[model samples]
Target: MDQERARLLASVLAPGVSEYVVLLMEGDPASKARPRFGGGRTYKTAADTAAETATGWALRRSFRQPWTGNVGLGCVFFRPNRQRIDTDNLVKHVCDAGNGIAWVDDAQITAEFGVVELDVEHPRTLIVVTRHVSSLDRSDLVGTMPRPRRTR
Candidate 1:
């Protein structure tokens, strides 16, 4: 890892983070490809399979155990070119790659954020998984909105 990336990883892995893992994968970020159908079956493309395997390995190196509770997933994709790709697909690729490794399941992710940007020199993907904490409560809504009037 380069100096900048090392610094970033340090900051994210700092103290006070009770349950979290940060993975910095250095490679061409891959978007989730649509499954191909043939021979009365559906399967992922070779590129997608390779990408997921690589990503899963990286996740395993950083995450010790799967998080059982709801988690918040965040990803930043740095692409080598200005190619058009859906951010949601990129997020999905990472989420799927982490299944059974970083978390119990992708459905356990209750919150998510994703970003795609260009970085020709160092194309990579950075993913952060943190335990989700609900920031809102019924008390917070008190006096924040007007109550509906009863109909006659």
Candidate 2:
């Protein structure tokens, strides 16, 4: 991440109220879990580890502030050890881990931005979670409304 962008993020992320956490996970970081039809879920080990890691980090830093309002979020995963991993699954793992610990719930995070890149030197997963505000632009809403035609 660029220094300027980090500075900008720091400005918005007020400590005690809102903040960000940079988690550096060794080796290839695990992705989100998927449930099966037979009342089962895959990657139980991975899921448990992620939850524990996230919660532990949150506890250590006292990131237990549960925000009632809509949250803004951005995450960047520097996955150097993994060859294939979708950003969606990775984000899911992050958001799920952050639930209750970082904020009230993942649903409260209305705004989200995520990026994944390879870092051969680091070979780790870097998660940057920040609070953000949702954009109020209603362009889609305007497009949905019926426009008036001039009959003159």
Candidate 3:
């Protein structure tokens, strides 16, 4: 993604006090799991909500050509199942805030594909959440299962 797009996405994140983790699975299907953290107080931007770089960063798998970039803008809020972080809320918040700048669905994200591309009315300063791929230490195909070759 380009810097402008990245910057715009980051701006709308409106990251709450609670930090998040991006889990990249190799060979695994396109599935997302909730973040794992020690249950505690929910941090807000006003409190000691300083930004920190995410560790254990690495791309655990390789994709074929024509592959789009890995980085995707997402969000989370205080919920009963923090472990199963909700992407739905993030989408709703962004869509509402953006007034149409970004388009998001269960399938894809297109920058500048919606009605309002940025939120100047309710300007939001977002927090960047870097996702580190977790397929490096596992088998070559960390998130994939081998299928028998089919004859035509």
Candidate 4:
């Protein structure tokens, strides 16, 4: 995750609002993967099993990298109501988290997903999300995990 960007997001989002840094790609292209919003699977470690249950609207990595060649600490923001605007028409906006926050338009974004891996050295699809902007959430519309009835 980018320290500068993180700080900017923190500033722009509502106080206590959930935010995360995700690696996104466009059509699984190589050499042009950029950071996307927060939302992915839960892994104990970089190679751990995925969480049985999804947490909030996003999933973040365990930790962040500081002054290291390789770092993996992603974030996820779970806002079910946040309008999913078209990437093609995304506007360049900035947040107060720090200074890296910029309005990312759809044309600039290749694809959207929580990062599953981070190959900082090489350009790859390691950074991706299990959920897409199109994926709809049925949490509130339904109940928290369906309940089972007792049978005789």
Write the residue-wise lDDT of candidate 3 on 1-152 in tens digits: 22354444444442222322232222211112223445575433321111110111121112111112122344322222223324453334333322111211212222111112233333222323322132222222223332322434
* The best candidate in terms of TM-score: 1
In each prediction, how many residue pairs overlap at the backbone (N, C-alpha, C within less than 3 A)?
Answer: 0, 1, 12, 21
Q: After superposition, how far is residue 94 of candidate 3 from its true place, in Å?
A: 1.8
Rank by TM-score, highest first.
1, 2, 4, 3
Candidate 3 matches the true fold with a TM-score of: 0.18
Two-way lDDT contest, 1 vs 2, winner: 1
Identify the candidate with maximal lDDT: 1
lDDT to native, each model: 0.74, 0.57, 0.27, 0.25
TM-score of each: 0.76, 0.61, 0.18, 0.21
> In model 2, what are the clashing residue pairs, if there are any?
72-132
Q: Is candidate 1 or candidate 3 better by lDDT?
A: 1
Cα lDDT of model 4 by residue, 14-94, tens digit = 234344344432221111113344458432332111111112111212112111111112232222233443322121111
How far does residue 55 in candidate 4 sit from its true spot (Å)? 14
- The C-alpha stretches of model 2 lying farther than 4 A from their native spots are 1-5, 8-27, 37-62, 135-152
By summed lDDT, the worst window of 10 consecutive residues in model 3 runs over 47-56
Q: Give the TM-score of candidate 1.
A: 0.76
Cα lDDT tens digits, model 2, 1-152, are 54455445444543343455554556655577565344464445655575657544653364534444556565566776557778888777767776656655677666666678777776555545555555642223323322332343
